[model samples]
Every structure is written in structure tokens, then in C-alpha cells.
Target chain A: MTAEFWNGTMAAAAAAKQARVQVNAAYPITPQTHTVEYLSRFVNDGELDARLCKVESEHSALSACAGAAAVGARAFTASCSQGLALMSEVMYFTSGMRFPVVMAVANRTLSVPVNIWADHQDTLVNRDAGWIQIYTQTVQEIYDLILLAFRIAEHEDVCLPALVAYDGFILSHASEPVHPLDQAAVDAFLPPPGSADRPLLDPARPLQFGEVLFPDWYPDFELKKHRALADSLGTIRKAFEEFEAASGRRYAPVDAFATDGAEMVIVGLGSMMKTARHTAEKLREDGVRVGTAALRVFRPFPAEDLLEAVGGCRTVLVLDRDIGYGTGGMVYPDVTRILYHEDHRPDVLNFIVGTGGKDITPATIERCVELARGGYRGRVEFWPDARGAEEGVPYTEEPAAP
Target chain B: MPNTHPESASASAGRKLHEIRLAGRGGQGVVTAGDLLGKAAVREGFWAQSIPTFGPERRGALSSATLRMGPEEILLKCSTAAPGVLLVLDPTIWTQFNVTAGLVEEAVLVFNTTEAPEEVEARLRGGALPYRLGVERCRICTVDATGIALAVLGRAITNTAMMGAFCGATGLLGLEPVEAVLAERFGKRASPNIEAARAARDAIRWRA
Candidate 1:
């Protein structure tokens, strides 16, 4: 792998270009415009000879991808926030057809506030929509995962659409060191898309596609889709291991840092995991038994992996970017189900922080660990980070700038 | 603070961690300054990242960018609270932004004003005592960066000018890499920016 400094937007675009995507059904949205724009540049410059479908709306963008994917062509697209919401219908249909369409989503907030910033609400709202949800923290993961998504999505075991996502501006705009593999290496790793998988549309071998399913037959299709979603976990791990062997960098279902013999564990999705991990390191200096567990693979939820990672901690802090309104943090509900039945479980504190583009700071993570240590249970009430500072009067000794 | 990195006294020491937040009016090239600083850091074999704060900034509206650089990799994506260096491209930025907000110990605040150091401190420090500034071992430096940029580049963009001030105050790294990065990014048009940066470096003075 070639190492270089790349922001998320450039990494995503570069991956698509290197993968030599056959079709790009394009649409432009805040934070995500660069992905398609960059691909279009490559195509125009003769670096990538792909069909560029400059679609009208995000709806058309995904629809065009679905149409292309059905014809056994490697298709890719990207969207964010409102565009994602508009294309929600097609996102489900794309996966239902088992097209293995790959998408990169710069997770942003839904409107009412109408802000263009980083938030988890956008991806969280669609967690149940049959797309493999993978959240990345660094620029390296963003580039690597875009290539991996196609492999996992088109695998014979899991023929489904996948969304390789990251926090919108936080990662999409932030620059970091990335290991960009040679095009020949990437090409060897990922076969020309659809060369391995079967497709519905064929001119020589005529076949009907997406016909109305009878009530009895529909359940079978749904069950198969559900099974693929659950069973894809193994394929994801296998691909990660193979990737690690090729590149010196390793990946896993859940990345745990400083978790061994820890009393407190903080868990989250997207870029905040890095901040949480950094806080754990600082707290480690202070002799605090703190650790971090990041949900690298969100769709499969990595429940077993999370269980093993957090089993040693006495108190687990779940910092959520998307709140469940009346139920508290969105991610907490699923995590609760896993630990509730266990005989020995860490007391989990759910913090609904950093919603709608606010930053989750190391100070905030420290506060949560402190609260969890003090036997704080259920949803948290303190606003000790930059995001909270934006909503009201400063509450922490050091309110970080957002 | 054990975590704090000492300013470079040698080539090996040059990779010290530095977090700089630059604030200025919309047209002042604050974001461009962050980009240039990052490029220079990379050229010097350090990891540099900048996040430009985009908003409804028209001509003179507040535009700020946070820049982070270190010897090793930086993992955190959040904005810097306790910056090692706080750069104010415009003196008026002090009124709107808490320019001194989260300053680590021995932090440097480099101003691009033509005023004397003591006078700028008096105007910037409010009526509060020196300790009330909330920073211990804070070094305040001033330079006529705008004057240098205007004269050399024929524009009021003080990014390169203040960059020179940063290098002079911190003595962070050699100006060779900075000039080289400028040459690459700006091509043949880099001469004026390089001159502005060098002039700003020469014009800087520290407050007692």
C-alpha cells in the first residue's frame, strides 16, 4: 500500500477510480459532491473509462446505479443528508434486488435545523434498511473500505448493497495520513465487478427480473436477505484478514483499545471513536482504568465482538451521536439487549451527545468515564463537551471549541 | 505538562506537536494560511491536518481554521481547545473570538498588527491582570504582517506573512521547506508569498 495524506472525500473518490468502477450514477450533495466530481474528472481525463450517469436527483442517482448493477456492471454512487432521505426508497429496492451496489455516505443531519455538518442521525435512521453499515475513523479506513465494500457486497455469501459511511465534515474534510495501494495490487485484490457474481439482466440469456412475488414466495426472499445480512459477518472478517496480510495495517469487526482489565469502556460509532480512544490514553496517564471499543462494522453490529471486548470492564459508556428521542441513545438499545441477559455485565451509561454537527471531545469522554465510575446509570444529563457548550451555558471546566 | 512538546532546537526536535488556530476576516486568506502551514509541515516530515470553518462569511465576516501537526500520527478529529499557537490574522478577531480560549501552557499568540507588543497586549488583555489571561508562560509576539503582505504580494493576505512570524517565534523549522511548498502550490507566482513570509519573519518582535 502507498501511504500519503488524503482527506475522506479524496480517498473515497480515489478508491472508486482505482477500482475502475464501470458505472457512476452521480448526484452532488454537500460534503459528498467531491466524490462524484472527482470520479467524473478521472473519466474525463481517460484515467477511468466508465459510464458517468449525471442524474437529476439522488433518487435518479441510486436508480441509475440499480439499473447498471442489474446488468452485471460495477456501479457506485454517493450521497449525504437530505439526498439520502430522498433516495431511501431506492436504497431498499437496490438491496432487495441483490445488486451488490456500493455507496459512500458522508453521514449528516436531517433538516428542520437545515445544517451542513457532521452527525450520525443520517446513517442511524437507515440502519435497518438492509445495507451493510461500516463506520471508519481515519482516512486510511475510508479508502480501504470503499474497495472492501465491493468485495463484501458482491461475495457469493452476501449479495447485497453496502454503505461505507463516515461522519460528514469531520472526516470528509479532515486530512490524515493514508496508505494508498498500487492500482495493480487493488485490481488483483478486487476482480472486475460482476465477473464473479451473477446478474439479472442478460441479452443472450433472456430472463425476467423483479417480478411481483406471491405472498408465500415473498417471505422466502425476505428470509434469504435476512440470512445474508446476518451471515455476511464471516465474509467481512475474512476480507479484513486478507486485507491485513496484503497491507501491514490490520482491521477487525470491532477495534478495542486499552480494554484489558479496564473498569470503564466507552463505545461509539464513526470518528468520535478516535477522540474516545485518545481520552482513554490520557486517562491511562492519570491511572484511570478506561478503554475504548469502536463499532467498525455497524450493520452486523458485531455483537459478539463487542461482548468479548467489553466483558472485562465494570462500567461501559455508550456515547451516541443519534438519540432515540424517548428511549435515549439509539445505539444503546441494541447494546442493552446483549448485556442485559449476561450474569456479569458492565453498567452501561448512555450519553446522547454530539448530535447535529457538535463535536465529541476528549473532555466529554473523560466526563463520561468519570460519571460511569461514580455509578451513574442510564441516560446521562451532563453537557461537558463542545456540543453541549453550544446548546447552553458552559458546564465543564474546559469547554472545548467546536 | 508531560504531554507538551518543546519547540525544536534541532532538526530532530523539529517534529514537535503544534496546534494553531487562525482567525481573521473572510477575505484575509486564513484558511489558505492553514493549508500552506499543513503543506509545509508535511514537507518537513510531520503529519499536518487543517479544518477550515466554513459558514456564512462574506467579505469581512469571521473566518477561522484549526491546524494540527505532530511528529507522530494525530487521531483526534475534534477542534483544538488548548492550541499551542493561536494566530490572529486580524487584530479585531480578539473582540469576536475567544482567541485565548483553550491555551496550553507556554502557548504563543502571534498577531499580525503593526502596533507595538505592549500596546497590542494592553488592547487585547482587557483591563484584567496578566494572570487573568488564564495562560501561564504565554508568549505574545507582534509583526506588521499585513504591511509585509500588502507590500510584497500586493494583497492583504497575511497567511504567509503570519506563517513567517510563526516560524520566527517558534523557530520551528527551516524556511527552506516552507518556500519549497509555496513553489509547488503556487508555481512561478510563489516569489511574492515567499518574500512576504520572509519579511514577516524579519519584522516580528516579542513582548516583555
Candidate 2:
């Protein structure tokens, strides 16, 4: 196999080129800029046959991509931070329209003070936007998951737009060795788009798409959207299974590391999962009975798989990178919702760590596990400190003696 | 860290090349070093790739870049945990990160500072480090690079100086290939930076 090294941004663009994207609409934003720049280069170099659309804003970018996908062309776009928040309205519309467009989201902190660092707040702000969300922990996973996203989104049953998120700077900027799938292998796995005979939107078919409705028909439309979203879980699983068979890389909605027979388990998504994994290994060495489960796919919340992953554990620490303001962490509420009806569930605790690109080091992760072991049963526990002071706080001691 | 070589005869028969990791604050040309190294390697007819890591903000944050070169296509796509060459542009990295955690025994460590190798080695007391190179008067190189950029390319960029230091230190790819790569990278502004790179190359001294 021909090997080439790529940063996270280049890798995503390369995969999109290989996928033979038909349309690309993007708004220029930091951290996310390289992905678009490389795609533009691919188009300029004639490596990709695609229409590159430069939009006025992030909202316009998604709108253009959705419009292109509605015409049954494989469309792509990306944005982060405030850009994602700006496109929140169209995000819902794109999914409800079943456009199957794929986008990369460099997970960045949403801000009133304008911070540009890694956090889940931007994407977490619109968790109900009717899109499939997958968080990646490594650059390799970022490349692999983007490829899987197209398959999952375009599945006949799913037919929803997908957003694959990697932590801004942490994963997006972190240089890592990624085994890019060979073009021949990728072509064999994902064949060229079948005949566009199945028109999602055709003037000849004369069908109404995304028509506004009053309270009278809105309930039925809402029900239909809900059903379609619920139907996506099976489609996601099947797609992942097929991808694993082809690529030899397995994925799950919730991936557990060293969770078997553990007394306490930490749940996280994106790059923090890498930290948690390392912490778990260290904790296990210390005989703390700690483990980690990363939620790979978060949209159609993998309740069954997540519950099963943490089934026998006594304490469950759900570490969220984004908070829900006065309420608590985002995933805490979701996990609570799942456990509310269950007969047996772990003592769920929430810890919000690493907001605004704060380093969530192994020490912090180990401390969270120690808290869980000490029987801290509070509904929410902001990690290290509640007010995000753990951010900007220097390490207690230098890593290397000065 | 031990290098793992496949037992198969076919894999063992080929010549092994080098991989380098450069770490520093953002805007320090850490990424540029990797790019120049890759370009220079390509000029020498070897496969090369450069990968950069940084946050959204432009400056005052941890940034790193990696360069991998080999005769055969390199398959591993992970960070250089056990880097064969570690180049630190900012001394703050020694305190900020576990930078030396997985350096291989025969690795080379290069830093841009006035501190003697013995002083830096003493600072790394408990830790067994690789070989060291101190590019004293590195700021002069940076200044020269800026001056050359203005005189030739009409912009102040330090990428050339860092590239020069890399070429001077490693000599993995000879000066001719590096100059060609520099010409390709900075086409209009090649002359002054070429001179600056050569001067910086001369400035680098390996610790005895």
C-alpha cells in the first residue's frame, strides 16, 4: 500500500477527494480552514470533480451544501464554534429533509468572551438538530469515521446528514500517524454513486419538501422526524459492521476500554477519551478498578450499548467537556434519562472537564476516578474545580526538573 | 525505546531512514521545520511527509510538527512517541510536557538556546536523554531570515532560518537538495533565504 502522512485536516480532505464529493460549501474559520483549503486544492488540481462553493457565512455554507445534496449529489461542508451555532437552523432542516450530506466539525468552545479552543459546547448547543453526531479521539479515527459517516448517513433507512467532530487543536491540529485506506480498497468498499434515478427532489415528481406547517400538521411531521431518527440506530450499526468487514477497523456507538469487571467507569467522547484511556490504564495499574467508555456516535444515543458497557460497574463518571449552564453536564442529563427507567443502573456522576481547550491530563482523570471511588454521589461534579479553573492552572510540578 | 524491526528478511534488507519531531510554541516555525525537512528529503529522491499540530489560536500555545523519511513507503501514522530526533525550539516545553518520555536511546536532541549541553543535561537530571545540539545565537538567524525575506521576498518569515538549522544539524539530505527544495518553496525570494539558511547551517554546533 502506498503510504502518505497527513494531518487531521489534510486526511479529511483526502478522504472526501477519494469519495468523489460532488459539491463542497464551506465558510473560512480557523482550525477548520485546512480541510477546506485542501479540498479547494483537490478541485483545483483536478484530483476531485466537485463544485466548490464559497459562501457568505456558515449558515449559507450548510444551506448550499443541503441544497446540493437535495439534488442527489454527494455534498460536503465543515464549520466550527460560532459558525456551527450560526448554521443551527439549517442543520435541522438538512437532516429533516434527509439530504445525507457529510460535514466535519472541528469541535471548539462557544464563547461570549470569544475563546478559540477545543470544547464540545458549540456542537452540544444544538444536540437536537436532527443530525447524526460522531466524535473522534485520534487523527486516524477522524479519517476513518468521516468515511464511515457517508455510509451511515446515506443508508436508505437513515438518510440523514452526519457531522463527524474532532477536538479543535487537540485532534485537529495534533499530528498523528494515520493509515489512510488505499484508493483501490476505498473504491471497492464504496462503489461510485449508483444511478441518481432515485430523485430525492424532482420537479417531475412534484413533491413538497420542508414546507412550513401550522400546529395541525406539525405534530405528524415531528413524529415522522422522530421515527426516522429512531430508525437510524440499526442503520448505523449495520454500516459500521460492513465497514469493519471491509477496512478491518471496528467501531461502536459506545466503545469501552477495560470496563469488564471494573468498579468505576468513566464515559467521554472525542479526544478526552484518549486521556481517559491512558488514565484508565494507569488507574488499573494502581488497582483502582477504573475503566473508560467513549461514545463514538452520540445522536441516536446508544442507550442499550452504553448501559451494557457500564452494566456491572458500581460508579459511573460521565465527563463532559461542555456544561448545560445551571443544569449540569450535557451527557449527564442523557445518561440520567436512560437510567431513570432502568431497574439496575450504576451510580451516575457527572464531571465537566477541559472547557475551551483546557488540558485534561492523566492526573485530572485519575483524580476523577479517585472521587468516584470515594463514593462522591453528587448529581454533578465539575472536575478539579466547578468554575473551570482547572483550565489555565499550571501543573503542580514541572514534568522535567529545571 | 527499542526499535521494532519485522523479522521478515525482505523488510530487514532495506535501508532505514530517520523520523524527527519538533516541538515549540505556535509561530516558532516548528511546522516549517518539518515541511522543509520533507521537501529536502523529496529533493533527495526519498519519500517524506510532514504533519503539524496546533490549536485554533495562532500564538502562545503548544505546537509540534513531525517529519518522517524513508526509502520505502512509511505506514505508521501515529505521533512519534519514540522520536529518533527531538528538536525543541522553546525550553518551556521541557516543563510543560512529557517531551522526553519516549525518546529512543540513540535519538538526537536539538535546542535553540545559549545553555550548554551539560547545563541542559543537568537540568534533565534523572532522565537519560539523547545527544544534544545547542544553536547559540539562534535569534541572529531569525533576524537574518527576516532581513533576507524583506530584501528578497519582501516579508518577514522565519521558516527559512528554521529550515537552515534543520539542514545544518541533520545533513540527512545534503545542502544541494536542501537548496533546491528551498528554491521550490520560496521561489521569488530564494536567494537571500538561501544565503541565510547557509549561514544558520554554519551556526549550528553539535555538543562534544
lDDT of 2: 0.72
Task: Kindly list the per-residue Cα lDDT of model 2 for residues A1-402, writing each as its tens digit.
Answer: 423445678778877888788999999887789999999988898888899997899999999998888878888998899999899999989988888889999888987877887889988888899989998887778888888888878777678889999988666765555678778877766646533334477788777788879999989989988888877989889878888887888989998888899898889878888778866877788788888889998998999998888888888889999988888789888887887787777788988887887666665677677766776654455555344334453234312201
- Candidate 1 stretches with Cα past 4 Å from truth are A1-3, A378-402, B1-16, B128-132
Mark the 10 consecutive residues where model 2 chain A has the least summed lDDT: A393-402
Candidate 2 at residue A201, lDDT? 74
lDDT of every model, 2 decimals: 0.80, 0.72
Q: Model 2, retained fraction of real contacts?
A: 0.06
For candidate 2, give the docking quality class from DockQ. Answer: incorrect
Which residue runs does candidate 2 get wrong by more than 4 Å?
A194-199, A385-402, B1-28, B34-86, B90-109, B113-208
Question: Which candidate has the highest TM-score of all?
Answer: 1
Each candidate's chain A: what TM-score? 0.94, 0.94
- Which candidate's lDDT is highest? 1
Model 1: pairs clashing at backbone N, Cα or C within 3 Å: A2-A180, B82-B102
